[model samples]
Target: MFANIIILILVLLALIFSISKWRIHPFIALILSAIVLGTTLGLGGESTISVVLQGFSETLKWIAVIIILGAFIGEVLRETGGAFRISNRIVKWVGEKKLPWAMGFTGYIVSIPVFVDVAYILLQPVVESLSFKSKRPVLYLGLSLAAGLTVAHTLIPPTPGPLAVASLLGVEMGRMLIINLIVATFAMIGGILWVIFFLKNSWIDYDKKLQDIYKEEQTTTHNELPKGNWLLDIMPIIVPIVLISTGSFVTDNLSGWVGDALGFMSIPLIAVYIGAFIAVFQIAKKDKKNKVNRLVEQAITKSALVIMITGAGGALGFVIKASGIQNEIVQIFSDFPFLGAMLPFVVAAILTTATGSITVSLVGTASMLGPIIDNFPMSPEIVAAIIGCGAFCVFHVNSSFFWLLNRLHEVPPKVLYKTFTAQSLIMGLSGLIGVLILVLFGV
Candidate 1:
């Protein structure tokens, strides 16, 4: 027992050092850790190899298609200017005084199928325009938009982080979507509140510095922006969420062909594929066949690295389970099962702080916790949500998104810390609260 505990500690320390200090790829780190753990735990060469392969293959079987399809949809949304249209139209509706609220909601919607960083960039112009006109601080709007985008980007699927964790933990896609939307909505609200209280007072002179610097670039990009229809822009994203939710509801309440059809549609892979098909037709450059093909290729190439990382995570998870470390830990902590619920949140927060990559945090923490949580009494879906919340926490100088916001707005460091970083912390804590409520009510 003592030996197993020591091996587990060593594996974790090595993982953190390799990824954070040595800058090793997570795929390599996870795979190496799995081999080392297996050897240390007395799993022979043949058994270790077999376990790793099985874990990797099984996890890919569930998530590979969904991840690729989701990425393709995101890529198309990104390249087509549809994502920009969605945010621009929505921001226009709410008008100036409520600019922060509108941008927050826009980011929430836009980020479902687009990366948060991409969403931030796509929506930055609208934010800048609003801030310029209203003379409101850009950080207010930037943090608002980022807050909404961050929660959905981390918690919800079709986004890679939560999707990978959900798949590895065997959470059904429909259920994952439904629960996360509820949890993420609350988390987003928390973020919006933070923006109002913390950032509303901080002001930057957009007309003097930012306007002179960015005016030309903004005008040129606005003219070149793709002119796509709004309905077509959102249909691909909305349809899947609706179909998946409806299918989940129907499968539970009804029967016969209708239920069976809903069940088929609700399958995450098929639902996402259907959305992808819809999105492909709305390509911003539909006339350029070569460009469209290239976009698809780009998405595929991007997804390949994510697929390998997720598979490697599964390999490490399988080895952990096989080593019986999970059982020993669970027994040791038997009196505090609630800690099991909180474990993912704490570990993911630490990893994200260390690595500055939410995907790395999600995949790595989920890989470490997935096996043990599988044996826990609560739902794995909830555990995945907890991990997602943790991954969304505390973005600082180390985060890429932090730098992007700084470059775009040039907010003072103190305001950036209080606003952007504080809002993220609010979102994460709010999500943890939501999870606690669910656990308390015995969900």
Candidate 2:
């Protein structure tokens, strides 16, 4: 048992070193780690290969379509200017005095489907405009908006990080969404309050390069496409979640034709398909042949690598479970009860902080810990949320998002450390607090 545990740890270390230091592709690293783990465990070659194949296929079958559909919806939302319109409208509705809160909510909604970086780029112009109009600090709005987007991007399903984590840990998507949303709200508030209290007086003076880019973006006119209806534009992302949740809740509680239909609608795959259909419908007849088709193709192409990495992680997890090391690891964790619950979160934070990629952090940590995941006292849903929360904490120089914040907002490194990093820390700790509360309440 000790030998198996040591072998597993070595394999995980190799995986991390390959991805973080050697710059090897994660898919390759994960595959190699699984192979090494199997060899060390004395699994026969045929069994090892079979387990890898089965795990990869199973995970891809369950998650690939959902990921591609999410990417497709995000592509449509980006191209339609719907995301921009939503943020802009929100800012106006809330008025400038509450700009940080409004931007935070805007990011929260926009990030439901879109990648956080892409969402930031799409909404940057509007946020800049608001900053200029209101005479508020750019850092204030930027930090708040980023906090909201970062939480949802990391916590919510179909955004990749949380989706992959939930899938790896065997957490149901409906439950993950419900619980993560609730916990993430608390984290988001922590970040917002940090911005409000600590960064209330902060501002960033635009540099020449940023000024020129801003001017260019402001001058460019968008092409004449169908103007997107705000609700219609957002429906593809929101409706599916509603349907899936309803299906999850209603299926067992109610019986009859109504129950059957709702239950069927709630299946995540079907629900996402319905959402994708709505999103696809948004492309106008004039643009469908040329633009919409291309966008869908692009989305699929883009999602391929993410799908591969997730599938590979699943393979590694299968090997771990098949090796019978899970029970040994679980028993070891049982010796420390609090550490058992917090282990996933700590692992996720360290990986994210080290690699600067939340997706990588989630896949790596979840795969490494997945075999013993059931041993955690907390429900799988809450455990998944803890992982998501940890993945978002400790945003710093190694992270691409940190560089994006630094470059776009032109905040100095020192200021970013004080503000952005500080806020992420607050949000992360607050998420942990929420999870602890739930644990105590026996939820």
Candidate 3:
């Protein structure tokens, strides 16, 4: 047991060391780590190879199609101006007085389909323009946007990170999505408050230079795609959310073929496929339906790397199970179930802070910590939410998102630390408070 404990610790350290120090891609690092873990634990070469392959294939069976479909939805939204429409509509609805909040909300919605970094880049001009014109600091607006994106990017299903976590942990997608959304709301609210009251008054309060930067580009880009229909714009995102969430909640209450039908429709893969199919209609009419093939190819191309990484992460989890170490670890936590509950979050947070990739963090944490996770104190789905919350933490030099925040927002390191980094830490800690609050309510 002691030897297995040491082996687990060493495997984790090596994984992190390779990712952060050596800067190996996570897909490769995970595969190598799984191989090492399997063999070191006496699975031997043949069994280790078999476990690795089985893990990879099984993991992808859950997420590959969903992720591919999601990528398609995002690409369609991006190309057809749906993302732009959503942001613009939110800004108009919230009005200028609440521009920061609007930016945050826009980010939350858009990020459900779009990648966080990509979403930020797409919305950067709007954030800058609104902040400068409203005489608000870019930090206030940008941090709010970042906060929303981070929450959705990690917590929401079909976004890859949380979806992968749920898959590796054997969590039900619908239940995890519902709980994660609630926890994410808590984090979002906490972030908005921080930006409004505190960071809004900070030294880098306003900048006029940003006004000139996006002026020409915004006009040219806005002209490229007409304003999309509001309902049409939101369909790709809302369809799956409605279907999966409703199915999870209502299917069990129904009976006979009706219940069976809802259960089948609610499957994440099918639900997301419906959304992606709807997104195809958004392709420009002038180019005809034939252009969709191009978009499909693009979506597949974009999602391929994500699918690979997810598969590798799955292999790592399978290897961990094969190690026989989980039984020993489970024994250690048998007397303290709450501590066991918190383990996923802690592990995920550490890995995220180290790797600067929440996808890798959640995947690594779930694969390694999943066996003993045994439905946790409440439910594995809730634990999945907790893991999502934990992975949302302090981002700094190591993170590409950190550099993007600095570069795009043009905030000095001091301001970046006080604002973006600080907000992320608050979100993670406040998210823990949310989990505790939910647990108290018998979640």
Q: Best-fitting candidate, measured by lDDT?
A: 3
Whole-model Cα lDDT per candidate? 0.80, 0.81, 0.83
Q: Global CA lDDT of candidate 2, please?
A: 0.81
Q: For residue 55, what is the lDDT in candidate 2?
A: 80
Ten contiguous residues minimizing lDDT sum, candidate 2: 216-225
Cα misplacement distance, residue 243 of candidate 2 (Å): 1.1
Scanning candidate 3 in windows of ten residues, the lowest lDDT window is 216-225
Q: For each candidate, what TM-score against the reference?
A: 0.92, 0.93, 0.94
Off by over 4 Å in 2: 207-226
The candidate, 1 or 2, that scores higher on TM-score is 2
- For this target, which candidate reaches the highest TM-score against the unseen true structure? 3
Model 3 residue 77 distance off true place after TM-score fit, in angstroms? 1.1
Deviating ranges (above 4 Å) for candidate 1: 204-208, 213-225, 284-288, 411-415
lDDT of 1 by residue, 123-153 (tens): 7777777666666777778888887888878
Instruction: List model 3 lDDT by residue over 1-443, tens digit each.
Output: 88988988998999998998889999999999999988998999999999999999999986888888898888888777788788878877898898768878888888998888888888776777766567677777888898889999989887998888888888777778888888888898888888888977664523657655545334423334475786888989999988988897888799999999988889988899999888877777887666787777888898898889889999999999887788888778778977887887788888988888888888888898777667356688778888887887767777889888777756777777778778888898778888888888887
